[model samples]
Target: MLDLTKLAQQMQGMSQQLTLEATATRQRLELAEKLLSHAFSRQNKLTTHQQTWHDRLSFTAAEPVEPLNLRIAIPVPPAAHTVIATDGSQIAPSHHEIAYCYLINVGRIILHYGQNRLPLLDSLPEVFYRPEDLYISRQWGIRTEEWMGFRRTVSEAVVLGELGERIKDEGGGMRDEKRQNRETRNQRVEAVASFHPSSPIPHPPPHPSSPIPHPSLAMVDGSLIHWFLEPLPGEARDRILPPVLAAWDQLRTNRIPLVGYVSASRSGEMVNFLRLQACPYDTPDCMTHCSNQGDRSPCQVLDPLKDAALWATQLEPGQRSPLWRSSARILDLYGDHRIYFCYVHVGTEVARIEFPAWVAEDADLLDAALSLTLAQVQKGYGYPVALAEAHNQAVVRGGDRARFFALLEQQMIRAGLRNVGTSYKEARKRGSIA
Candidate 1:
């Protein structure tokens, strides 16, 4: 009797397992049938001329407007949380190397002397003005029209965060590590080194044998360098030293800002400036030529000090001057009562596009711009076609086949793909047989 009871239990367990397996199989089969029906229906609806037209269009009709390249500058105070979002494909075809940046809670954005905005202002505030608002106001004689484009760019920045968050929330197989690495890179750590100095400072030399550092660092004015490298007392220095060192290490491996010249011809002037600064490193080969004219031409050298001079000139603040604007202007903008600044690079070789001010103030407008931009890119590159294909495949293979079929039917009706007299119920009924 005990053996008989054990056998019966085993049989019951097997029966349950078999039932589940059969149910899963049935669902998969139904899904396949539904997908076939949907495809067939679509094919039937499209006349031969429509199919030919679609084939000929080839998704290249929606080319994006050529990107416009402009320098953008935003004044970030010490320790402010600044978020910068960049989309490479939005402005042009992505070439694998795209830059993104984020700045965190710092001081007020200096619109003009004595005007500023509070740190951490929301993207959209219901009340345009408040007594304690720290944002730079146009009423203070700051130019608003010039900065309007920057605001639109920042609103789009939110899209980067959204894309990141979506990837984090949705876990898939194999690509998890890649997504994590991207998130890690996007996170902005607090900067330990300060760029502002309170007192007169001493000059620090570069390590004796490092390659000429990027020209941008070389061009940092003496005053700015002193401020950036301002000394902290023993205890404070010890506390921040580790992070500063880490940042320095990261900068070495990553693309630190290189000095940009107003013109390729002025490179020699920059080289001379670096020599005066007494930097020990070599000049970049790309910036200057060998001075030795005889049979023995001196090995062309990079002048680090000159590079720094060029960098400083590039970073200088002036609207009309050739040397004053760097690429930073593409990131800052002006708006009603406040100035919005971003420092992310968003552009392509063809054109570097910046945002308009109105879009930045309105979330809906920002979304619309992104959607439109994405659609344009998709039309040009066939990205949307790939996405549509993948989505169709997933719907066809997903569990709950009946529900999937019902949804497809509803879509068809909404799309006006079928006659009003024929309900989804009728189409679905006919679909199963066909």
Candidate 2:
């Protein structure tokens, strides 16, 4: 048991140390900001420096697509648009459980603004017990829990793609029906019209009943960088990557803007770039030029800073920083779906917003991504409402896991399999004195 008296005494000392650290952090932040401003002042030179030392850099830095210091105020989102978000949760396979299996539940949310209709909220849960489902290549040494998480990510993307496709098809059918109806009406009017040969016959006015197509934005709960695949062998990574890429392709084909929203992100990609700017050496080669300097390196002044913390000081609420293309090695395999990201201040904290190359390249779609995100944040009071709801739908509680195992054991006994058992540790933890 933790000793309350000792803990309280330690906490007092810890608080004093934290106060000193906070002061130092503020001074360091000021220096980092000045470096950022200096880099912005010489944007062209910095760009050339990065390009020149691209391979020799000690850290992965994002490639700026626009001026690094550019900040855009959030524009008004479409009065009527749909936002679809997905989140997932999983019960990893455990050795202590009565059954060696896992479960994945993906929650989906669709909210339409200005439609005056009820939102759609639901979840898909699937259980996996088959040997093939529980394992990848034994030689690859991927843990079951790790594989389960990867599977959950793929499942979320697939569900998002499915939702985007359904909405696109519905929109298409509506347009087709409207076109056919207008053509039929015009044909009937032309057949019955009686007028002078030289005079023009009036056709029915353009149909006002057709609903205007509202833009759609798709959001997922995390990064689309696929950085986790970098360390895996090509064959192993290929097994997990194709499905995600195909799902992204589906969304692109449907012309839906897809974004991955990371709340209070601690990513240091931009901070690393600022460090690159602070490099004193002409070549900026860390190994050859700065290896001997150790803690005295100029770039170390910006140590321990995150991209969000840096941008939080620069962006106002409802504003977004300039876009940057991620330089992660895994993105090379992403092809047309290269991931691009920017930072947005969501009123409560800085958020990293990421989407595909296509979304960033298109003006209207990009606007939808930015504006709808801010709108969602405002509606949810600092986070996207759809994403928050999707998480609620996907969460798996302790009681649910307990019931799942109980049901599993009960079913096994009914099937004439009486050997269902849990590890001694698990039984003891459950307060069962078997």
Residues 1-434, candidate 2, lDDT per residue (tens digit)? 58998789889899999999888878878988998888888777777777788677777888788997789998899788888889999998999888899999999888878844346688889999999888764558888888888889889999998877655544453456467775464544343233222343233322322322778889998788877888888887888899998998888877788999998787888888787778877777888887788888888887777888888899998899999888887898999999999999888999999999999999878998899988998999888999999999998999988888888899999999977989989889879555
Ten-residue stretch with the least lDDT total in model 2: 203-212
lDDT of each: 0.26, 0.82
Q: Give the residue spans of candidate 2 off by over 4 A.
A: 174-212, 432-434
lDDT for model 1 comes to 0.26
lDDT of 1 at 160: 28
| Candidate 1 Cα errors over 4 Å, as ranges | 1-136, 172-434
Report the number of backbone clashes for model 2.
0
lDDT score of residue 403 within candidate 1: 43
